[model samples]
Target: MTVQEQYPARYYARYDHAATQPAPVTGWYDVWGMSDASSVPDAADLVALSAAQWSARTPTGLGVQNGQIVSYAPPAPTLAAQARSALVQAQAATWAKFGSLGKTVTDDWITYQQALSAIADGSNATATDLPSAPSS
Candidate 1:
C-alpha cells in the first residue's frame, strides 16, 4: 500500500479518567504513536483489551480507560489577521515619531504609516517598503 493507505495522517482518543490527579478531570486524550501499528488502536478496543489483560490483578475503576474518539485540526488565519497586524505596526511607528532623530526618520515614519494603512484597507502594500523604527 502507498503511504496514505499504510498510515492515517491523524489518530484520536478520549479518556474516561484523568491521566493525572489533584486537578479537574478532562476526559480526553489525543495520542500520536511512533509507528502505524501503534497509531491504529481504536479507543473502545484499547479500553476493552486493557480491561481484559489487567482486570484480574487490578482494582475496579482504576488504571487507564478510553471513553470515545475525537479528531481535530487547527484552522488558518483569515484576512482580518493581516489587517490587524498592519494596524498594530502602524500604531507603533506613529509612537516612534516622538523619538525621531532627524527629518529622514520623520519622513520614513510617514511612509511606513502610509504603507500600513494601504495593507489594512486590503490594498497591495509590499512589506519591504516599510522603514525600520528610528533608533534615536
Candidate 2:
C-alpha cells in the first residue's frame, strides 16, 4: 500500500467556516469533505513517507501533496537519531546540574555539553555513545 494509504492525513476541520485552532476539530476531510474532496487540506504527515520514498531521512521525514511538501512526525528513529536525542537530554541535564554555578561550571562539563552538540544524527551513533556525565 502507498504511504498515504498506510498513514492517512488525519482530518481536523474547523467547527464552522470561521474559526481558529482547538475550538475543537469537526471533521477529517480525508474521510469527510466539503463540496469537493480534492480542494481543502489543513496539513500533512510526512515523516514515514520520506523514508519510504528514499532510503535516507531525518527525524522529520518529507512528504508532498498536490505538489507541495509537508514536514511533521515520522516513524521511529534510527540508532543515530536515538543517540542524538539522548545527547540532547544529557545536555539538558548538564545544564540543570550546573546552571546555578554560573561561571563556575567546570571546563570538562562545558566540553562535554559541546561534544553532545557536535554529534550529528546522520551517522551510526548509538545511545551508548552519549558523553559520560561529570562526577560533580
Each candidate: how many clashes? Answer: 0, 1
List model 1 lDDT by residue over 24-117, tens digit each: 2223222333434444444443332233332232222234423322222224454445556766866666665554533344666666666656
Task: Give lDDT per model, in order.
Answer: 0.43, 0.46
Error of 1 at 108 (Å): 0.7
Shift of residue 72 alpha carbon in model 2, Å: 16
Mark the regions of model 1 whose C-alpha exceeds 4 Å error after superposition.
Answer: 1-80, 96-105, 125-136
Q: How well does each candidate superpose onto the true structure, as a TM-score?
A: 0.31, 0.34
**What lDDT tens digits, residue by residue, belong to model 2 across residues 1-136?**
4424444643322233332221222333332323344444433422222323333333343333333334433455655565567677766776777675564667887776566556554432443466676777
Give me candidate 1's TM-score against the actual structure: 0.31
Output the number of the TM-score-best candidate: 2
